[model samples]
Target: MSSPLVFIDGDQGTAGLQIHERLRGRTDLTLMTLPATERKDVRRRAEAINACDIAILCLPDRAAREAVGAIVNPAVRVIDASSAHRTQADWTYGFPEMTPGQAERIATARRVTNPGCYPTGAIGLLRPLLDAGLVPENHPVSIHAVSGYSGRGRAGVEEHEGPGAVGAPSFQVYGLELAHKHTPEIQRYAGLARRPIFVPAYGSFRQGIVLTVPLDVRMLAPHADAAALHACLARHYAAAAHVHVLPLHQPGDLKHLDPQALNGTDDMRLSVFSNMEQGHVLLSAVFDNLGKGAAGAAVQNLNLMLAQ
Candidate 1:
């Protein structure tokens, strides 16, 4: 008749710290963490993980995997906030609003993989269209996203805000090698047959993301058009609590979208903009990367896990 014990594996990192802050002072469960000296102790870390009712992993891909490998207790459910298990077959994806009954799946899942920040936006836009045959499976998709410097995680936070750091670039595009880690995640989850081009940039601001994917209406199916695309997205997220698709043909939609608009919350907004004369449609998603993208997502999954 006691509260559940929750452990955060890498509480020093940005995502972990944020998760801790969100869960702090809550009387529902006990938050557990290792001291700095014992943080790297393998056996101690394993003990902490296996002892918790839930373990939220906010470590790097490698460390996250290792932490998962060390869990011997079947009761210790996990919500990994890393790229390590996103594509894994056995782990349930932790985007509760992603699809129908996805929240129930997260509620019962023993191994839930928290989604990457970029894939959250891309998949949110593409999944419904692909499933409805609006967009072909083999469509060569291209995603361009601008996230605040915090998207880079702790390193980015340091580069932009650390005491030793100064004069951080105003904006910078990365993943020039065309091999970003989020590429496979986006392609796989978005159900695209061909590899998509993802160009992600970092702005000088702290949190939020603006991800845009453009489509050629002419290249789509016979009846597929901008309106149809918008309807598909709107229908998909109509009942969703955290993800909302803006109405089509808004008078001044451009004036409303700012990356930092949803900074403190865990909701995401998807908007479709098009020029009928030009045959080009741009789909964009705006949200707090650290919220819907990382920490808030983990906490949501944990809440689901505890509710059941």
Candidate 2:
């Protein structure tokens, strides 16, 4: 039998380039590409997309949607690496670790929407607790996240890393309007009845992200404490391959967290730190925005599709 054919529609952009690199030399799938001259030609693009068993769209939201529309083959599966269809009911949200049997859904899905970078961390941290009833649906949740410059896509990369670029900032907060693109998806998947307040920022680095959520122990039902929160997350993700829950309260040896610690891999780490006496807890998630957040996720979905 022939190996499954995979085409990456926007293979030159940040997310596309990363997906191409990760899929390079893979044995299970045959990676296909178009020449630069024909990259923008709609006919050529559609042909490439239709010829594949699976097509991965790494373009902007509009372009990604266009690419999906261009596919005429009913058998061609799609993994869209954009926010275009995240909240759409017809498309499966592509975060395998989000729940059990999610991977199987992706494997059979005709359209899979890759999750947003910030939502990946936020949902990863909150979903388990919310499911366990540790965090109520209407809980007043607030998320603060810092991502490397790469999370901004092409313009951000050019501004920070390109020649003549005015690179670097100590720290800067965005989404002041409290209406971020990822908010809907976060609320939907995190099982929140009320939208959470999200504040995101881009640091000087190129990749990786850290998202923090603070909780008050006294507000939880039964007066659940910090350890309970940690235990809930730990138990939920215990069997997950890429998601790990770190133990809370390491005595005096507990160290400060670093955002860039897991830069190159597709793994995401979660930690909970709490002080019952102080009635406070801090839940955090660390991951590579371009990895588990985007490209790695697309590839993982591709693997699931082909495995079917």
Candidate 3:
């Protein structure tokens, strides 16, 4: 049998570059990328996309949509790494460890939408709680997170590390409009009845994410406490290979988190902190934004698709 031809539609951007880098050493399939000179040639791109067994889109929303529309081949399956199709009903969400059987669904899907980097962390923290009913759907929730500048893509890299680079800032925050593109994706996938106020920021580093969501245990089902919350998360993720729940914080122990802790791997860590007397708790997820949040996720989904 012939090796499957896999094409990357936006091989020059941040997510695209990482996906390419990770796949470079693979020997199982044939990889395809348009030459730099033809990257923007619509006819050539469309023809190349139609020729592959599967296409992984790492382009902006509009371009990803255009590429999807240009596919005339009946056999072409797609994995979109843009926010464009994430909320669309027809597309399978591409986070495998997210829910039971999600990986199987991705394997069988013809159209899969990669989760946003921020949502990968946020939803990873929220979904299980929502599903376990530890957090009510109507509960007003707020999320705060910081990712390395690579969240901004090529421009971010250029500003932080390019030849013309300005020194990376120690810290920065954005999405003040309260309408970040990842909000809806997070809300919908996390199963929240109301919209969440997501406060996202960037740090001087290049790639990693630490997302936090604060909740009031008083808002949970009657008699709920920190241990209940922790048990729920632990139960839900116990069998998951890549996602984990850390041991609860020790009494009067260290109270800090470093975003760069898991910078280079696809694994993720989830931790729960709470004050039982006050009915308050904090949930955290840490992972490589460029790894699990973007390229690593795309590659993981690609493997599922290929296995089927």
Q: What is the lDDT of residue 167 in candidate 3?
A: 62
Pull out the clashing pairs in model 1. none
lDDT for model 2, please: 0.88
Give the TM-score of each candidate: 0.97, 0.96, 0.97
Alpha-carbon local distance difference test for all models:
0.92, 0.88, 0.91
Q: 97-151 in candidate 2: lDDT tens per residue?
A: 8987888898899999999999999999988888888888899999999999888
Clashes of 2: 0
lDDT tens per residue, model 3, 253-288: 746888889988888899988777776788999999
Cα RMSD for candidates in order: 1.2, 1.3, 1.2
Q: Name the weakest run of 10 consecutive residues (lDDT summed) in model 2.
A: 163-172
Which stretches of candidate 2 lie above 4 Å from their native place?
166-168, 250-252
After superposing candidate 1, which stretches have Cα over 4 Å from the reference? Answer: 250-253
- How far in Å is the alpha carbon of 257 misplaced in model 3? 0.9
